[model samples]
Target: MKPTLNEQLRQNIRFTYNEALELIVAMGMAACGEQMYAMAQDYKIEMDPMADSFYEDTKARLSPHTFRELQFFFGHNFLHKTLDFGFYVSICSNPEPQSADDWIRSLEAVPAEWMLTEMVFGVYHDKLEELLQGRDWEASKGNLSLLAALVRDTPPHQEVIHTQEPLLECLAHPEECKLRYMQLLSQFYKDVFIRWKEPLKERSEQASAHYETLFAAKPEQFIREIHKNEPEIFISFPAAFHVSQASQVGNHFLNFTTAAGNVGWVIFGIHNERVFGPAADREQTELFLKAFSDKRRLDFVLLLKERPHYGQEIASALGITPAAVNYHSNFLFFLDLISVKREDHRMYYHLNVERLRELLALTAKVMLD
Candidate 1:
């Protein structure tokens, strides 16, 4: 039997640790393409068009300069989004490009479309700028505000605006600004769909297939069996479950719990799961309850420390049912381990790290001894 995704991921974790895993989770397919590109670039490998259709397709829509900028932006976003996982882990674990020249050479080696989005915004950008040049600065700003708002609420407006300030400055008429913004936004959607629709569909299908196989396996049973046979493989936690490689069943190779008590399986060779010490025995369970009143509450604190996640994000990370995340997060707030900030209607939970560490240390000292 092939090692499941979880098994592959567990091995990856052991070798590469958590940063690589987080990169995979947060960046998904994009990060994979980047690593491949970096490796090829460093080794002076030629880029293969067939394998890199995504990057190529995205490049076709832009000028050479803009395309280079886009790559930089994408790469920067990739690193920024993954910063919490730590820098050293990212550098040492993956195959990365050694220099700028290497990156350019690597780009030559990979299939373009595989690494880049299909949508080309260059043509539309020129047209949109031409339209905006006749307008006043205030009108342009208003136009941009309207477009930004529409992008979030309306699915049709998906233009990758390179510089919002420039676009805003070019608009002439206050009333006409809305109309032009709508036109630009609509064109963006149309262009994206036309250029990359098939690839996007394929990507979606691949993701669905990957997850379907991942969620289908019996995660708990796999974890328990691994714990029984390869005891050393499992990482123990005082109040949480162990982390270990599951049987090479299906597409999952490793399993671990979220700070919120949800069990998740990662794809093969993506090691992102944090190992807590061990599952709580009855006595330990009782002690865990006494220390924190609820394990979920403690899990909430962990989630905040792990990332700057909102409720939905926390819920997804923890693999807990949505209702449970909200419920436990409320409890955590009440306990003063976390604070909820309201932006619009969405609430973001930030961890009180000092408080959390103090509590975690106190609890660990009591439980371990």
Candidate 2:
């Protein structure tokens, strides 16, 4: 007898995290933290002027080389099938802690061309051969910004013709840039993670335990049980990059990943459904109350509870524009109360019963605690 596709998919899921992975993720997050610099005052997180400039410089060097690279790092499901631009990281293998030295070695081992390809072609990696079948990269430097000049000098431009010279710096030396940036921030990384060591360890432990329970349960119930407010998850496999980072910021979750060899990320957000359960801390409870207080949001939730509906359909049902529905949908999505599933080009939204339940339960627990 043959197993079903879902079984095959479920077999791939694993409960895992590693110190090395966390370190890299932490570095990336730290790099991106400057964007939320203004919000630090709310948490009383000190904002250093010099640190802000440093993060800016770091972002420029580590900037994603391609659109696909950007999508992966931001933890979006956006991907192309030709390259498997988004592969599932937690599916096949469990992650184990790697010493700092081992992590450096792992970084060193990453192929230069592989990193370049991820930045340049990414989802369109399969086309790299055809795109540069016989072009001399060094020779085409003069035509950096002009596709026509490129075609005149190098015939290959006539193939998938276009100009993207700004990204050339990245393609030229991806490995060097990546390593240098990581090295530059090594001291800061060491200091920050060391300071947050205890919390990181606790969160990592909680994540591992939570996943253990989920894996032991039925696959069909996996999404249903994740968080009480989690809308019925209908996302495709290999599309999510789930990172397990223990941070109070990002609501204990954020989207981030760069194509680590054809894989997408799924952010478990440390405060994962299993680990933190449905409990919303003080800050989150305030946010939820404000978001949930709206009459429109209330109607939207009740509507989704009945069945999954696309933005336009939901809007028509609620007597609002699709854009308005989209806005509200995004808020619900951020709260994990709703999820999206693509059918053709349309993204259908449905209630996450688990998230809803968790939100209510946690709201109560938080109030009492």
Candidate with maximal TM-score: 2
Q: Which digits, one per residue and each the tens of the lDDT, describe model 2 over residues 35-103?
A: 445444444355444335434544554435432242223221111221112112222122334544455
| Model 2 TM-score on a 0 to 1 scale | 0.42
Off by over 4 Å in 1: 1-35, 39-51, 77-194, 220-369
> Clash totals for all models, in order?
46, 28
- Estimate, for each residue in 1-369, the C-alpha lDDT of model 1 and write its tens digit: 887645543443221112223222322223235665664453334344433564445445544544343333233322222111222222222332122223223334333221111111211323444434454433543243444332233222134343233223322232343333233323323433245434443443443343334323533334443222232233331111211111011122233344444232323311111111133233333443554677666666666787667778878777788798877765555435678788768888888878766556646655684
RMSD of each: 20.1, 12.2
lDDT scores for all predictions? 0.37, 0.48
Pairing residues by index, what is the TM-score of model 1? 0.24
My TM-score estimates for the predictions, one after another, are: 0.24, 0.42
Query: Which 10 successive residues of model 1 have the least lDDT summed?
Result: 240-249
lDDT over C-alpha atoms for residue 266 of model 1: 26
